[model samples]
Target: MELTYKNSKTIDSEQLKNLYNDVGWTAYTKDIELLQQALLQSLEVVSAWDDHNLVGLIRIVGDGLTIIYIQDILVLNEYQNKGIASQLIQDVMSRYESVRQKVLLTEEAPDVRHFYEKQGFQSCDKGDLVSFAKLN
Candidate 1:
């Protein structure tokens, strides 16, 4: 299968919702309107498409200058384990290569850590940094 990537923020909400659902991120898929608004306001977005299908996406938020937070990076289950996630991340890192800080909050999993580490991300613990978050 051929995969195409785009750096765009014009994705349809329904398509975004479906992809989120496919990955079991029910938290976002449950509120399509909120999801759409969040996507609309993101500083940048990189998405992967399998022809007409939206297969994966990575969203960023924050000013382009100082710090950029990787809000979400998801690939449909069937589309995982390919180089899609890596490519998507490379695109973002390339765009923000000069930014001082690039951050992401994700579940603590060995595979997850390995994946990000492969992309040149150092965990907070390893880097002697601390991260805190508040979810409401």
Candidate 2:
């Protein structure tokens, strides 16, 4: 497969929905309009495509100067383990290489932690930092 990546903020709702669904992020797929708007509003986005098929994506939100938070990174289950997620992250990190703080919140799964760790991320405890979130 000739995979290509694009740093774009625009994605059709249908395509975005399909990609989110394919990755089992049904919570996102359930609201295509909201998802589309979220994609449009993100500070940066990197998407992977196989021809016309949307296969993976990552989104970031922040002030673009002080802190950059990686909001989401996902690849189709079939596309996982092929380094697509890593490449998307690499692209983001490269673009924000000068940013002071980079952050992401993810489930505390071993494989997930390992993946981020491999990409130079450290757990909050390991770094002597604390993270908190409030969801309404």
Candidate 3:
């Protein structure tokens, strides 16, 4: 199967939500509103496609110049081990490498780490970070 990756304005929210769920990632539960905002926020985002199907996605949320946080590296289960996700990351990293190349938070998968390591990301135990959550 041929793999294609690209930066897109297309936001197939339902397809993404289903892909996320199939990959055992947390369910966003058809949150089209959030996906709409996310699609708007994604800077230099990359997606993997097999024909008309969206098999994978990687979102970069940050200033175009610096501090790109790589999140939501989702690939459909059937498409795993095909190196599509790696290509997606490479697509994002190539442009940002010259500016700022620090991936703050990753989903922490060994297979994923192996891919990143191949791309030159060393394991770091302690580093700068932050988080906050609010519920009503």
Top of the candidates by TM-score? 1
For each candidate in the order shown, give its overall lDDT on alpha carbons. 0.93, 0.90, 0.73
At residue 4, what lDDT does model 2 achieve? Answer: 92
RMSD of each: 0.9, 1.0, 3.2
Cα lDDT of model 1 by residue, 15-66, tens digit: 9988999988999977888888898899998999999899999999999899
Pick by TM-score: 2 or 3, better one: 2
In candidate 2, what are the lDDT values of residues 25-118, reduced to their tens digit? 8998777888888988999889999998889999999987889999999998888999999999999898899999999998898999999999
What tens-digit string does per-residue lDDT give for candidate 3 at 66-129? 5887767878988887788777777777778776656645667887677778877776653564
Which consecutive 10 residues in model 2 have the weakest lDDT in total?
15-24
**Candidate 3: residue pairs that collide:** none
**Candidates by TM-score, descending order:** 1, 2, 3
Q: TM-score of each candidate? A: 0.96, 0.95, 0.80
lDDT of 1 at 94: 93
Residue ranges of candidate 1 with Cα displaced over 4 Å: none
Highest lDDT scorer: 1
